[model samples]
Target: MRLSDGPVALRPLRMRDAQPWHDLRRENHTWLKPWEATRPVDETPEMSFANMVRRLRAEARAGRTMPFAITWSGTFIGQLTVSGITWGSLCGGHIGYWIDKGHAGRGVMPTAVALATDHALQTMGLHRVEICIRPENANSRRVVEKLGFREEGLRPAYLHIDGEWRDHLVYVITSEEIPGGLLNRWRATHGPLHA
Candidate 1:
């Protein structure tokens, strides 16, 4: 499935995206490394791009994740995934995303996130969506703040990022809080001003 508004879009990541995806990651190594998750030192070797895509596709098919390519003007710019979905009483998921440095600060990430969160809440019938960002990631925090997600609290050593465990700020929004949908709320609050 694809979700879009104007120039920003979120579509399933395809095998064909491997090259562009690798190029973006390679180019943005310094820009993204600080915020990227790191595998445990003793974990198995990383999978190839093709295998990674296959795993992501399998997760999507199993209803455990939605892996999307963040696109702008018909070009792949990054990735956004709503993962760790829980059905029972929890009925919620967490969002994780990254954008190429060239696309930063243009409202692309926020728009992509809004679209994904809306899909999770409206179509998937999820109860809430959460985003955890390192305290140092001001750009990412701004995205959630712009969307009006409430700050829950700090999660000490939440996830291993870069080379060590990092403290993360938890932010969340519930389905009921965005009855009109996240995209609609975003547009109303941050859209172009009318004369």
Candidate 2:
């Protein structure tokens, strides 16, 4: 399923996107490296893009994840994933995303995130959605805060980032908190989503 708000859109990631994705990563290497996840020394080397896509696709098929390619004005700019989905007693999932540095501060990322969160909570019938951000990542933190996600707490050594374990501040929003929808709430304050 595709999710969108004006020019910002999230669609299923595909192998056909490898070239542009790699090019964007290469271009934004310096800008994104510090916030990007890295494998520990004990683990195997990073998987190839093809292999990574294959694995993510498998997870999507199993209903464990929704890996999406973020687009702005129909051009691929980044990625967003609704992962770690849980059902039954706990119907929830967390979101992770990144955007091309050129697209930063333009409201694209927030719109993409809101779209994904709405899809997870409204379309998929999930109860809650969370976004974990490095404490130092002011931009990322602002995205959720602007969307009205409450700051839950800090997670010590949450996930491996930039070759080291980094502390992340957890932000969460439950379906009951926004009966009118998060996107509507965000739009109410931010005006139009597109630049």
Candidate 3:
């Protein structure tokens, strides 16, 4: 919730978000289809919003994971979630997100990512965060590179994306990388922010 971007907030998904969520998801269908889990035949675009909210709430209440919807100016813009969490040895989860196509490149994801990452490290007590991206997705690569996530390696034929097996570039940023505070971390990774 404490992101640098004004009016951008993370809130639990709700049934009321159904319509806007459907519209946004349908808008980004082809764009996001490659990266997301396969869609089911029984579901229409309209039903997806309710499904998302239901799933997120169930997961949260079960202590399985945390899911957040990104909203700006009363519109459902996107979603970010931390999944596959492990309590011990790994203490990690994969970070996944997507923004409304119209709002891309607006500094939305970075602030949201930083805020989410801070919550993971400082609040959830997680150690490492992982991001797996298709090698060709330059925008996503920029996000990770800007955030100082080290490129671990490529896993060939790692994920089913866009109806085919695609290689994924694994990236990670540990809690130790943050050093002292958010500003320092941002400066260290992305250089000085211009006034």
Candidate 4:
């Protein structure tokens, strides 16, 4: 699947994207390290980029996750995944993303998020979408804030990050919250996000 707004777009991650993806991650290591998820037990070894993408593709095929490679002006710059999806009585998923340090601001992440959230709720028939942000991550929090996601308290010691468990604030939005759709609301508030 692909979603775009001006220069920002999201597409299913592909194996051919390995080089750029690795290059960006290596270059932004310091900028992104603090927010990186780490394995606490080390029971399972870390996966290589190719292995990671293969596993994500398997999950995508199983309908458990939507792993997207974020692009700006058709250039790979980041990633966004709507994971932990559940069906039946509770149809929902949580989103996680990180962008290149150079594109940190300029409405790129917000537009990408809105596009993903809209696709999740509108096209995927999901009931709700959520994002969990580390309380100290003001940048990530700001993205959800700009999109008007409701603050739903905190998840203490939520997920392991930067080598330790971290507290995260839950932000959520349901289909009912944006009957007219999220991208429309984003455009209404922020205008076009070209360039």
Clashing pairs in 3: none
Q: Pick the candidate with the highest lDDT.
A: 4
* TM of each candidate vs. truth: 0.96, 0.96, 0.83, 0.98
Give lDDT per model, in order.
Answer: 0.92, 0.91, 0.75, 0.95
Error of 1 at 87 (Å): 0.3
Q: Give the number of the best model, judged by TM-score.
A: 4
What's the candidate order when arranged by decreasing lDDT? 4, 1, 2, 3
Tens digits of per-residue lDDT for model 1, 69-141: 9999889999999999889999999999999999898888888889999999999999999999999999999
Clashes of each: 0, 0, 0, 0
Worst 10 residues of 1 by lDDT: 186-195
lDDT of 3: 0.75
2 or 3, which is superior by lDDT? 2
What is candidate 2's CA lDDT for residue 180? 83
* 102-178: candidate 3 lDDT, tens digit per residue: 87776667666776777777788889888899988988888778777899999998877766778999998888888
Model 2 Cα RMSD, 1 decimal: 1.1
